[model samples]
Structure formats: C-alpha cells, structure tokens
Target: MAGPVILLVAAFATLVAALLFGGGAAPLVIADAGPVVRWGLPIVKLVVNLAAAGMLGALVLALFALKTGERAFDLALDTASVSAAVFTIGSAVTGFFTFVNVFNAAPSADAVFGDQLGRFLVDTELGRTWLITTIAGAVITVLAFAVRSWTPTLIVALLAAAALVPMGTQGHSGDLANHDIAMVSLVIHIIAAAVWLGGLLLLIVIRPVTDRAPMIAILRRYSAIALAAFVVVAISGTVRATVAVGDLPSLLTPYGGILLVKVAALLGMGLFGAWYRLRLIGRMAADAASRHFWILVTVELALMGIASGAAAALARTAPPSETAPAFVRTPAEQLTDAPVPPELTFDRWFTAWNVDLIWAFVVGFGLFFYLAGVWRLHRRGDRWPVYRTVLWVLGMLLLLWVTCGPVNAYQDYLFSVHMVGHMLLTMAIPLLLVPGSPVTLALRTIRKRDDGTRGGREWIMWAVHTPFAKVVTHPLFAAANFVASLWIFYYTDLFRWSLYDHLGHEWMTVHFLITGYLFVLSLIGIDPVPYRFPYPFRLLTLGGVIAIHAFFGVAIMMQTGLFAAEWFGAMGRTWGPTPIEDQYIGGGAAWSIGEIPALILGVTVAIQWSRSDDRLQRSQDRHADRTGDAELEAYNARLAAMAEKDARAGR
Candidate 1:
C-alpha cells in the first residue's frame, strides 16, 4: 500500500519536473503568470495537498480520540480518514507535480489559454491524448480509491494524475513561444505536503502511548508506516526536480535557490530521523527525557509545510528575476577608463570559502574524537584527565570564537554559505560536545569528593537528574537554538551586527554553535543536562518557538523595504537588493507553510523519547517490585543498621 502511494507521487513529480526544467518556458512567455499557474498544474497540487492535509488533520483528530477514548471528533475523522497515511503522501506528491504545471507560460498564447485551458493545449493529437490521460487517471484513481481502502487507491489515482500534468503545460521542447507554467513553488509545495502526509502515517503505526493492547506490536507497525513515509518523501522530491529543471544554472537561479534550501532541510531531517530510529532509540529506553520524539516530529512537519507552500507561491512568480538584463545598456562599455579594481575586504574573503575544501576536506573532526572520548571518561570514577578538561574545552571555545569572521565573511549574500556556518556550530559541534560529557565534567571539576562531603553521591545524582536538567535537554529548548537564532538574526539588526562588529560576530558564532549543538543533543539524548521537563511541555515549547521563528522570516519576506542592518546596506547587498522573490522563498520557509513537514520532524524525535521513557518506566517498576530479592533487601537493611550504629558511636 505504501509503495504504490509513493509511485503515484513519483509519477506526478516526474511530469512536473520535466515541464519546469526541461526547457519548459521563460517568464517572457507569460507576462501575467499568476492565472495560468492558478488554473493549470497548481490546481492539481492544491487538490493533492488539501487532500493530504485533510488526512493528517483526520489522523491527529483520531489520535486524540483514541488516546482519550472520546467520540467527539469521530465523524470528522471518519469523513477525512483514508486507510493509509503513506498512500496519501505519495498521491499528494502527484498533486504537487500537478501544481507545478499550473505556473506554465501560456500568456504568450493567451488567445488560446486565457480562461480556456482546452484551447491550444489540447488542440493537437498530442494535447488531446494528454487531456484524455488526465481525465482517465483522475477517474480511475477515484474508482481505485473506493475499491481498495487508502494506500492502493491513492497510488493508482496519483499515478494517473502524474501522467496528466506535463501534458497540461500547453508547451513542449522547441516551442519557445510557450512558457513553462511549472514553478519551483509548485514543486516544493507538493514535496512538503507529501512529507507531512507521510509523517502522519508514521504516527499511526508507531507505538501509541494510548494503545492498551498488543502495544509493542502496534509500535512495530507504526515504525513500518514511518519508514514508508520516509521513502516517499525522498523519492518524490528527487524525481520532481530531475524532470523539472535541465541545467546547473537553472538550479542556481533564484527560483532554484529556494528549492535547494527546502531539499537541504529535508535531507537534514532525514539523516537525523534515521539516526534516532536505527541507533539510539533503544539506549534511551530507561531515560525519562525521551519524550522529545513528539516534539521533533512536530517541527519536522512544520518545516516541510513552509518549504512546500512557499514553493507554491514561487510557482506563480516570474522566471529567475536575477537573470541577466534582457537588454544590457552598460555605461562600462561607454567609458574608456579602465575600472579601478575594488580592494577585497574581509567579508569578501569569508564569503568566498570553497566549502568543498573546508567543510568536506578539512572539518577538523579529530578534535571531536579526542574531546568526546575524554569527556566520556569524566563520567566514570575519580579519574581526572591528565590535563584539565575545562581548560581544553575553553581553548576549543576560543577557536570557535574566531569562526565568526571566517564563516560570516564566506556568505556575502548566499543562503548556502550561511547554512554551512549554521551546520558547523549547531549540528556538528553539539553532537561531539554532548558525548564529551560537558555537564558531568563541570560537576567533577567543581566538587571535591573526598573532602568530607555528606550525602555526596545522592546530592550529585539529584542535581544531575533534576527536573530542570531534563527540561533544558528537552527538544523544545534545543529547537530554540535553531528557530530562535534564525528569527533573531535574519529578521532584525542582529543579523547585520553579528557580522559587523567583532564582539557581536563572535557571540553570534558562539550562540549559533551552542544552540545548534544543544538542539541536536536534546533530540538525540546523548548528553545529560540539568533540566528535565516532561514530553507535553517540550512539544508545546518547541512548537511555539518554531511558529514564532517562522513568522519572523515571513515578516521579512512580506516587507517592501530594506531589512538588513545599515552596515549590510553600505556593503551593497541589502535586504531589498534582489527582487522580493528570494526573500519570499526564505520567508515561506520560515513560515513553515510547506505544510506539515516540521510536525513530522517533531513527532519523529518525540516517538523515540516516548519509547525510551516507556521502557525505563517499566524497568524501574520491575526493580522496585522485587519482593523476592531477599539477599539484596537484607544487604540494604544491614547497611542501614551499620550507618545508624556509626552515627551513635560518633555522638
């Protein structure tokens, strides 16, 4: 069922991508691109996205009912519910390709396309065949959906729909008069929607906290659902672009830039999710703080939404606005004087970092190996490192402090460079830092154990395992690192200042790395912290933070005026330097309108934590109920008596 759903999504993605990228059309082909897009494939994506969204909404509602044993939302869920979420995501993917087809460049042939899609598009034998295909597919899919519950019907319908999208585009190769209505926006929207749908399916199959029967078996089923979703998200995304755009420059265009970001975020989410499911979900079985899985799933779903929906809007916009001016009337050609070469500045140098060389070739990962191993050692007995761990950490901190200049300088205006900096400080560093066991080291370093301390182990344990620690390590606080930083830096003067002044820049880098690292750690549960908040609190906290952060990005995009700091403006690449388009893409990503992707991410993390917590709670309960362990009880009783006698003697 899951496989077929995915295949349908793939078919739709392929058709849309082919039209968008395969020399489809340029903005010149359609002056008023909005309506063409609105009527065309965009409508198709909208249908799929809306359907997928309905399914997810239903799933969430059903989950609530199941958990609480309530009947209130049953009708709504029943009406919306499809047999399988995995199928919905895949079918929705076809909808996305249909979405891309909407923004085709048919304005040049308005006499044929204006309020009349059946005109030039379906006039020819090829066009007529394509139209027939779409009608046929939509009908068959509906029939199939009725016959077989969720997944199978969705696959058939979606596959048929996918074949119809490219044919809807009214143009083909060598038809330069016709433009490609298939926008990046539409493609992104479809991808994001699929992820959202897939994630909801994951929720159904996963270990439902509310399930009272064959609980473990149910969890295994949930895992399978999540796996299906994961595969669909990846496959659909890949196929869409492969068929959409043809060349490297197309990928580099402003339209493509946004697509790149969405894809990157998806990739990151995928890698992170895989790690949790495949590796550490079990080790955390006894930890109380594992409930963060839900929070991660939520965030992942939300991000996916922003990326996809923004893409939908982008689909309606003109072709790459940053392309070479159609008619170049340059004063440089008129002037005989040789232009003086501008002196290269620090920002220029930093922005020009060949990431292939630095991030790929010279990551300096050895520091992590040594640092994490040394820190882990600190978790054990009184063995201090030959050298002080605090001093070592402080020194590494100094090295990172300098990353501000290099990282910031490398990203003049490109989002990708900025992303690299984000990755380093956030994802890579924190993963290593937690394993190094910074929290435990601080404790060992500060306390002198042999110095007549009463209730030493108990006191230390209590502080280490406090509610406060768990809360800080929770996914909510960690997401604050990612979501909040993006808001603070991008939407305000903070972004400019972080790159302008030395100190501000330093702190910016510092905060970025710390937050990023911490967020990942909190999700994964590698290190222990001081605050241990419950799952519900973490989910709400992270969700709220993500919404606010996404809003800030949206605000920046919606504005018509300049937003970058004064210094940034002086440097020539202000917020409004480019057409409001790129900003729009970024904003959409920030808004998380790509649909339910972030939610999925939040849930993925949350499930892992829940599974861990459930296992631990059961373990502790077993140990606590050991009425048959007479020797262990006797040992404790004897120890209690000896302690009493020792106190009396001292008195």
Candidate 2:
C-alpha cells in the first residue's frame, strides 16, 4: 500500500510536469523559439528532480538498513528511501531529455560553445530547465542520503551548496539575493528535516533492540537534537513558505493551493511527531508497544515525503526569473559582454577553439597515460613495465609546458584567470594524482633496483613520512592552508598586483598551483602523516577555516561602497559590487554557513581518533591483564626489581 501510494503520487506529479513543460516545448522548433522559449522544459525538469530525490533517498535507506542489520529504524529509512528513489528516478528519466535539450544545446561560455548557444540557453526554456534540475539534484540528494554519517554529511552539505550554484548569475533568475536566501533556508530545512526524521527512524528501531532503561539516556540526547531540528525546520520553513507563497492570496490560487497542501502535510508530520514524543513514545518505550511506534514513524515519514515533493516543485519553480538576459540588436547596444576573440567575435568559445580543441585532447590523453601507469604499478607492484612511468613523467612535463604558453600570452588576465585555474588545478588534478601514489610507488621500484636506501625512493619516503610531513598533515596545517592562502593573496595586494604584470603573472600561476597542490593533498589525505588530533580539534579547525574564509568574503562584499581601486569600477557596474553589500554577503557566506565544512571535517577526524583511541586503550588493557608462565613471571619480577634498584640508586 505504501509503495503503491507513493508511486501514484510520483506518477501524477510527473504527468503534470510533462503536460506543462515538455509538451509545451513543441513551440521551440521555430527559429525565434528555441527551447529557451518553452514552458515544457521547466515542468519536465521538476518531475525529473522529484524522481531523482526519491530514488537516492531509497538507496540511502537500504544502505542504512543493511548497516543496522534489520533494525526497525533501518527498515523505515529503507522504506522512505524506496519512496524517495521512485520519485528521484522517475524525475531523472523525465528530466534527462530536457537537460539534453537545454544545458547541452543551450548557450555556454565561448570556451564551451558560441554566442548562439548562450542565446539559446538565455532566451529559452532549456536553460531554465537545466538550472532547475542541477539545483534540485544537489538539494534532494542531500535530503535523502547525506545523513549516513559524517562522510555523508560532508557530501550532502557540498551538494546542497552546489544546488545554489545555478542560482548565482548563470541561474538567470536575476534575483540572486532572493535565490541566495532561498538556498540558505532550503539548506537549513534539509538538515533539520533529515536529522529530525532520521532520528525518529533511529529511535523507533533501536528502542526495540535495547533495554528500556538505556532508552532514557539515548532519548535524552536524541530528543534535544530532534528538538533543535524541529525549531530550525519551523523557523526556516516559515520563512521559506512566506517567500514561496508571496502573500495570503496565494493560498487561494492554484499554485498556492498545492503549496497549502504541502504545508498541511508537513503540519501533519509535525503533529504525528508531537504525538509520538509527547503521548505515545514514552509509554511505548516503557512498555513493549514497539509496533505503535513503528506505525507512527511511518506516518511521519509519509507526511515528510509529501511535503518534500511539494518543496521540490516550489524550490525550483520559483515564479519565473525577474531578470531577463538583455541582448542588443545593434552591435554596440552596450551590454556587459565577456572579452574574447580579439581578431573576430565567434558564436561561442568553442567555435573559435581550433587551438583549444587540440590542447584538450592532448591533456586528456596525457592524463589517461598517467592513470594507466598508476593503475599498473598499484596492481602489479613492479617496474617490469618501466617505459610507461617515463611516459607519465614526460606527459606531465608536456602538460605543464602547454599551460605555460597561455600563462605568458595572457599575462594581463592572469590574476582573474589564475583564480579559476587554481580552482581546477588544485581541485581536479592532485586528487587523481595522489591516489595513484605514483611518487611513492616509483620510489619503491627504484629502491628495489639498488636494494638499499642511500638515495632512492626509500629516502624520499623517509622525508615525506617524517615529523615535518606529520606536522603539515595535521588538521591545523590543513586549516591554515585553506585559510592563509586566500588572505595572503587578497588581503595583501601582493597577490593582487602580482597577477597584473606579465612576469608577476607567471610566478603567480606557479605559486597558485603549488599552494593548491599542498592544500588539496592535506585535505584529501592522500599523503601519509604520523601526527594526529582529536575530533573536537578537527571540528574546531574546520570551523575556524570556514570562519576565516567568510571573513575574506565579507571584506570583498563590503568593497561595493566607495572603496579604493579604480580596477573594480573599470570592470563595469555588474562586475564590482557596492563595498558594504558585497562585504556583508561575502562575510555572511564566509561566517554564516562556512562552519558546515568544518563540522564535517571535525566529525571525520573525531571518528578516526575515537577508533584509534579505543583500539590502543583496549590493547593496553589487554596487555596489562595478560597471563603468563611462572618462569616468564619470575623474569618479569627480576626486571621489576632491577628497575626499582636503578630508580633508588638514581634518587
């Protein structure tokens, strides 16, 4: 019944989405009416979004159940996830065609496409559809599967943030501020909903397996968490609802009517939660009325599902963007235009990318070679195939040289480009490189040839696996790397001025890559280190770094007011923000929610620390309690006496 009911709701939603969005897309075939002009795409996208969220949620539940080994909470999470998966997969399939016609066909940066592409995306329904799906995917996944552990928390948090990406400028919503607010509120809603609901799942499942006496302790801690989650859901939800509904009259409107239904569902969930906690749960805990608890939680889960489905629609289907892309018929109608194609204007970046096309392939194949070598060594643990390793090194050199060419030619744009480049190099490259352990593995191969550790890879290992390595690998160091780099570059204009000149620009790129490499290495934990810290410290440091990052963002945001730097103004009005507002948002982004990443880090570190501590403590306790033969005991006693004698003598 639960399965069929959820599936029916999902199918109905998808059908409504199809009629409104995809069916409407037939208008796009006209020259003036590409998909960007259609309504069907957005509707289809909404359906896809719901489907994906539903599917992923189900997968998460199934995994949780397996881990719990058939606990009731596990079973419920599994059930809820099943429902979620239905919605998610259905939405994804329905939305895939739209994404194909939208972001894929729509206009992208010239580097990716031409001006016509941008026009198609900006002027059409296709862009809207893609934006909605991307953001929705990021959000829904977080809600469903992001809560397995700290690891999942980190993943989900990141995805939730990603959901806000399209809401930025490219989101074409023109209301970045509103979108920002919605995104933040939505994130709060998801975290609160998952924690609160997931806990209910846990409370129901665990209580049955454990004794009632322990329930008090468990419930005491969990209830506090659920309470906090409830408060967040209530406050943020109210704000979200208010913004979404726009006014009281909306309740009577068709769209508003759906929203009301969703709200009612959430309210029902809340009521059920109250009943379980206030009336039924206590008695259920004391007595053996576990079935009643299950029944109530399932009801809550069902309500949450309904509410989430409505929210999925409301979140992305924001009543059309207020800001429309302004295209000028006259070549000089004077809009904010990206600077490129000095010789001639092209449709998109890719349109003029004869040179870039070749470069892309070069980089792609080179990376493939490097990866193949890495896999071979890791799998075989030998240098019998030595030529591939050489090719790998040469390929890296070639890649660096290729990048160097652009570094010299576009020195003027280096600073801005450097920021973008750093993000890619640090984020994309090292994670792949380190996991292969090429450096270490290569060293191992070299050492075997010499059969000694005088000056081979063994020595390299000694250096990397040393105290300094340990220190750098510490949470403190990673935090420092993440925070200090930005402040050093931006707060002090040394980084700023450095990128403006040709020579300085070259050095800037170099530094950017090196720093990024270290930062990511520390973050991804690919390299080995001995020093460690506790979870509490890890969390604090993570929070600290986020706080620091937020501070920089705040400072940049504030620059919108009459601050120094003609460069900012020269970039045009849109490029530069008012110092005060920019500073506020920058800091807000930095401080307001930056702690999320840190919280995740702290959890990871804490879990590791806890496991290690437990193992060490247990080992020590076991060793102390060891039983042995008489002779061994006598020998130990003699050694103790000798140690006592030596201590007395020294005193």
Candidate 3:
C-alpha cells in the first residue's frame, strides 16, 4: 500500500512539475480550451500509462512465473483487474479531454457541441484511435475481472497489450520523418516500460506475503525481464530522441531537456538494478537485508515515476521540424512521408540502409536467445553442432539485411527490388534458417514447464502438434500455400497494400517467411513433426512447385501491363527503368533468383536421403553382428529342405 501510494504521488508530482516547466499547456491559450483540459489531458494520460503497466505487468508475471491456485497468483490477478478498471476510466477521461482539446468545445448541454463530439468520435482518425483504445481497455477490464486461471489471464493480458497499439499509432511518429520506425519504437517502448514498472510494483505488493525462497525465485525471474525491458527502452528511447530532436543542438531545447531528464531517470534505474542484482538480491533471504531491499525498491519506484512523468510530458512537447528547408516534395515523399532515394544500382544495394526498428529487435533477440541456448547446452556437457549456430546467425543477419537494407529501401518504388526481397524472404533465408533447426535446439535446451503453465518448450510442442501445423507441414499443402500466395498476393490488392501500408508490409514479410519455412521444413527439417514425406515424394513436391513457380514467373513476364501500377508507377521515379520494364525485370528475378533456392533444397533433400539410407544399412549390419548370421543360416537350411522334398517326390 505504501509503495503504490508513493509511486502514484511521485509520478503525479513529477508530471506536474515537468508540465509546468516544459510549456506543454501553451497550446491551450490559442485553442481556447481551459487550463483544466490543458493540464488534465497529460495527467490523465500519465495515469492511463501507469494503470496499463499495472494491468499488463501483473498479468505477464502471473502467466510466466506465478503458480496457479496460489494466494500470490490470485492476488496478482486481483491487482491486474483493479489496474484494468483504472485504465478503463483513465482512457475514457483521456479521450474526452482529447476531444475538448482538439475541438476547443466545452462540455455543456448544447446539442450542437454534443453532435460535434459524436462526429469527432466516429469520423476523425484521432477520435477513432481513442475510441478503439477506450473500448479495448473496457474489454480488458471486464476480462481481467472474470478470468483467474493462467490461460484466461494470459488472453486478457494479450488483449490489454493490443489496447496499447492505437496509442502507439497516435504518437508523435506521424509528425516525424521516420514515421514507421518512430511508430514501432514507440510501441516497443510503451509495452516494455509497462512490463518493467508493473512487475516491480507487483513484487513490492507481494513481498510481505511470499515465502523467502519463492520470493527470491520470482525476483530473479523479474530481474531478467526488467533487464530486457531496460535494453529495449534504452534503444527505443534513443531512436525516439533522434526522431524528435533531429540534432544535438535541439537537445538543449525544452523538449530535448525533458527527454534528457527521462534518460537520466532510466539510467538511475539501470544502476539501481545492477546494485540490486549484484548485492541486494543475494542477501534478500537474510532478515537484515530485507529492509535494505525495500529501501532500494522505494527509490527505484520513484525513478520510474520520474521517467513515466517525463514521457507523458515529452508526448505533449513539440518535436523539431521534420521537413528540410527549401526542399521540393516529390510524389513519393507525399505518399510515404519521406524523400525519394537515388535510383537503384549495384552499388546502392550495398550502400542503401533503412533501420527497421522492429526487425532489428527481432534479429537481435533471435541471435541472443539462440546463442544463449547453445551456451546452456555446452555448460551441461551437451555438444550442439557449431554449424547450426553459425547458420542461424547468418540467416538472422540475412533477414536483417532483407528487411532493413537496400531491399526495404527500394521495394516500395521498384518492382524488381521488391521481387528480390520477396525471393530472399520466401526462399533463400528460409533455406538457411530451416537447416539451423531452431526447434530442435529449443526442445533440447529449454526447460520443461510442468505446472500447468505454458513455457517456451510447452508452447512450441503444442504448436507443432496443432491441426494447423499438421496441414501446413504436409508437403503438398505446404508447396501449394507457398506457390499460391505468390500469385494471390501479386495479382490482388495485397501487393498494393504492402506497398502503401507499413502494417501490411510487416504482415507480408511474416506470412512469406512462415510459408517458406514450412515448405522447407517439410522437405528437410531436423525437428520432429507429425509426418514427413519420403525423399522421392519430397523431390516430386519440389519439382511440381518449381514448375508452377516458373510458370507463374513466365506469366508475369508475358504480361503487357504493370502490376500494382498505381503504386509503382506513381512513385514518380525519374532515374529507374520504366515501370513496365521494371516489372519485366521483376519477373525475371522471380524466375531466376527463385530457382537458386529450389536447387539448394533439392540437393539438401538428396543428401539427407543418402544419409538416411546409410544409417539404415548400418543398423542392419549391427543387428547381423549381434545375431551371428543365424537368420541367414536358417534361410539356407529351409531352401535345402524344399529341394530334398521335391527330389524324393519325383523319384
């Protein structure tokens, strides 16, 4: 009780101070909205963030670490429910205040203002964002109250997490030059911060009731989570700062100063975490050390408050200008919110770079966890293949390049480049990734969770055994899905959506990667599955897929008209090949670059088949050695007896 109260008080005080000094309410003067709205909006938003953290963090801890039917677990869920209720209220308040702030309409009995409010909620993008968020919060509040079990609580937690998405989308990202990256970074930042803050609060709340051993275990688990969150927050904060400030000089400005204050708070928390991990946590089992731990936690909570407050204030502060001076806008710039790059060339493939925050994190975590798994295996005297690790690392690196390098830079503007990326995502990258056998490694390394809770290993096994997995892993079905998606995506509005929408692009990437992985896995996966085709059938599957793929490519090449011409043509690129010619080149890439991976898959399947035969023959020879040729001797004796009987009957 004391800890939470302190956290709230600290958060409110710092938020108020930051807003007063940061000029966050200055726009109210021009908008003619009273100070109540000007001041109330950020305050409500801050409370919303805190409550969200509490809801999400408590649910995550309950799912991941807390035991079912335990008092601590129930307490955590109750806390989540209460937090969600507050979140719902806070969100509604924020939305209403936002309405007042944007329209400068005071709350009154007038029907005209009421109509305007109704219109704002339904028709405007901002209104829609808040309305969706508020509704999601309301749903989460109800779900959290009704659900107490692990899986149900987990679902509620996911719903709460999803509720944060619209808020992420509505951030200052749209005003920034790197809109997509800013939006992604903001989303990651918000979620990670909530988890970190909420987990700490839960720890404080449950400390008194938990036994020492279990409490220590919980603390250790949470420490790892907090460390991960800290890293994400740091990286995302830097990206956000870069987007908002634009230059070093801008850091001296009020907005930048508030950002700096937030960074400082984060740094303080990090240092405190280090001390807690290295010094305090080990001693937490000692009666004397408990007081020290509580003191440290109190200080840490205060820092969290400061950081959260600064974040709320920073949201309201004006970012530096995103536009360049005296720069003429191109059609691409108008559509994409960024300037067009130079024409694609061989050199540009190596030189062009766009940092996709999402994939960057994906690759980073993939490498870290995979390597960690390998290290754990080694520590336990198990020898994981070095080549598997090497292949996994290389595959992830290629994925990063495909997503964030030249391919991503030019894909929207150039059809050929888009095809090149699509080929890599759907074929080349998966060929490497499938051979890495990530599932095999996970099954071998990740500890089993048997407490009626889903952990990494449990979830992976469950997923592999699901009906959807069985259907997808079937060679014929996998091949069709792989080939059909190409036709459907390119021929339909999906391609245009991918070109125009960031979320659509992400979905395209994920869909292609999964389909490709399943196809390759059906052919050459090392992990256990429901069924795998024999080598001959595998070869036949590959052959049929390749033939269809080639025909699809040829169909594209023979087409006289451009695909998604509205998007690629309208890019207004002056230096690249004409849109139709670019489409021809893309067709060639689909036909040519796409074949390389098919050949690789064929060769891999052949090698695996040969190995399978060799292993089978070896096993038979070992059985012969063990039996001393007794079966062979018996067969020869039986043949001799049959001959003797035939001779006697003839005589």
- Top-scoring candidate (TM-score): 3
- The digit string of per-residue lDDT tens for model 3 on 69-184 reads 88888888888889988888998888899898888887998999889988999999899988888888888877887877766786798898888878888757787788898898
Provide the overall lDDT of each model, using Cα atoms, as 2-decimal numbers: 0.45, 0.48, 0.87
**Candidate 1 residue spans exceeding 4 A from truth:** 1-409, 419-492, 517-526, 565-604, 617-621, 628-651
Error of 3 at 76 (Å): 2.6
lDDT-based ranking, best first? 3, 2, 1
Better candidate by TM-score, 1 or 2: 2
Q: Candidate 1 lDDT, tens digit per residue, 382-451?
A: 5755544554454345334325345443343433334445544544455445444544554444333342
**Top lDDT hit:** 3
TM-scores of all predicted structures: 0.31, 0.41, 0.94
Badly placed stretches (over 4 Å) of model 2 are 1-95, 99-177, 187-229, 244-252, 285-292, 312-484, 487-567, 570-651
Any runs in candidate 3 off by more than 4 Å, and if so which? 27-29, 109-111, 322-328, 448-455, 633-651
lDDT of 2 by residue, 341-380 (tens): 1322223222322122223334554565456556665677
Which candidate, 2 or 3, would have the higher lDDT against the true structure?
3
Native-to-model Cα distance after best TM-score fit, residue 392 in candidate 2, in Å? 51
**After aligning candidate 2 to the native by TM-score, how far in Å is the CA of 496 from where it should be?**
11
Report the C-alpha displacement of residue 338, candidate 1, in angstroms: 20
